[model samples]
Target chain A: MSNEETAGSKPSEKVIELRLPSRLGYERVAMDAASSLARRMGFEGDRIAALKTAVSEAVTNAIEHGNQHNETMKVVVLLTVRDDELIVSVTDQGSKSIDEAYVSRVPNISEAMQKDDKGGWGIWLIRELMDEVEFTKAPGGGNQVRMVIHLER
Target chain B: MTTTRQHIIEISFPSEFGYEVIAREAIATFARCVGFDRDRIDDLKTAVSEACINAIEHGNKKVHGLTIDIVGVYDGNMLQIDIADQGIQQYQVAGAPATIEEKIAGKAPARGMGLLLMTQLADEAHFLPDTNGTRGNRFRLIWRERVETLEPEH
Candidate 1:
């Protein structure tokens, strides 16, 4: 595809669908989609970069911790722009419980904790970068992490 | 005899976002001193920002009257940044077996993805628990030579 051809391409008014494989290499693909959506929504510079960082962090969570890099599973990123707010919903097929209290609480101990961290830290970063973050489950079944960042006017 | 021209900057902030800003300025200074390219400097800034933000938000989380220290070193070609915060050590987020989407859908919970981004952002990233057991967190960001000139533009 030519650069002009691609640049002229517009973000679909409908939900932009992306099927990211459950692998480490597909991270860039996901980041591109998220950043493209952010720019199209008129997010400039730092705000755009912030959106990319948040999106990448969320997708990385989906791949490494969520899907456990399961080959059979797939990650779906859905983008929707509402006014000055950009809403991103990333869904993946994994079975686990969503604990809001656990995700938000600050860790209070590390004496017995190993220096080499085994797991933990993605969601906290997301909350820090985005204006608002929430974890909501669909009635049908699946995990949905909704992240919203309000673009500056 | 072999010598590497590495410059170090120490910035101390008291519960302020200045920690992040100073870290960035230190990076720009180190990059110019080391003669790194524009693109490379930008990359270093992004990676450094992520690390500094992590330390301020996670390490200093609401703790007042604490200082965050950042040191930038330019080894002729490579750039190394060390940022420290004296706060209780904890994984900002937990790693879950389910993806973030799944967690948001209430099917599962999201876990430690921040560390992953930090690792990917920089060439080398590692966290060291305070060896003195004072609850200090030290995070490092390292990258290779990015350019061949070290001149500042006026």
Candidate 2:
């Protein structure tokens, strides 16, 4: 009953795929699903919290920016659990391409406070929290953010 | 519940013995956000896990390589979940047993003993035939937005 099957990747990776509507609160589904996998993989409490926040930010970005809040568009979340790390990939059906200039920008607290919209910190926060982060165009021509967190004993 | 627009979450995974843990957690969280009480969510979780596992075990005779697809929709007033799998066919249990779609025809009272929890927990559940060129047995469970309801007798 415990036979491990590969999830369309490497022999050791197990995947859980979720296709979510491009909506705001739907990100919670990604957060809970990733955290559940992280907890089972023996991640500490704080690590689990970080994973949730990273997931939330990535999915929200996909919904608001990539899909442009289109209800018909889908935000696809892939939770891949490996022996050493957990990799989360959030991709959207891009109605708009993500601006490459803002991918790695660091936001200043005061400067963001002055802006009318207090957003734009999500991409920065994801980089700071995760062990490895990368942004690339997904196979479906959408924006995809891949974030990985090491499972430490 | 005051918010407008519909919410949909679709999940797919390989048909295997495990993985029910992840699916159930996702479903429960979605249910909670849609305003179901804690008790209803718990019941929902159980039914979800069992129904998925049963699908895997009953379909194809070989669960390896098959896939389970679930689509959940919340429209502020009700939640409808469609669970479908790509199996060769459904294997029946002993006795004058029936499948889920059979319940609609009044051919059976329940979807065998395996799906008893789903029948009990959901306000309405039925097995529907494949449409849109999709394959496999599909089961739908419907629950209206939270309201005062009586508890079942033990």
Candidate 2 lDDT by residue in tens digits, B1-154 = 0233788888986677667778889999899887889988988888888778777877644456567888899998898888887757754333433666788778777545656557788887677765666557777788887566999999
Model 2 achieves a DockQ score of: 0.41
Residue A121 in model 1: lDDT: 60
TM-score top scorer = 2
Instruction: State which candidate has the highest lDDT.
Output: 2
Instruction: Spell out the clash pairs found in candidate 2.
Output: none
Off by over 4 Å in 1: A1-14, A107-114, B1-154
The CAPRI-style docking tier of model 1 reads: incorrect
Q: Write the per-residue lDDT of candidate 1 for residues A1-153, one digit (tens) a residue.
A: 011111122342223345555655455555655676566567887887877777877777777766777745767766654556777887777776557785786654473275466446667778888998888774435577898888788
Position B39, candidate 2: lDDT: 89
How far residue A68's Cα lies from its native spot in candidate 1, in Å, is 2.0
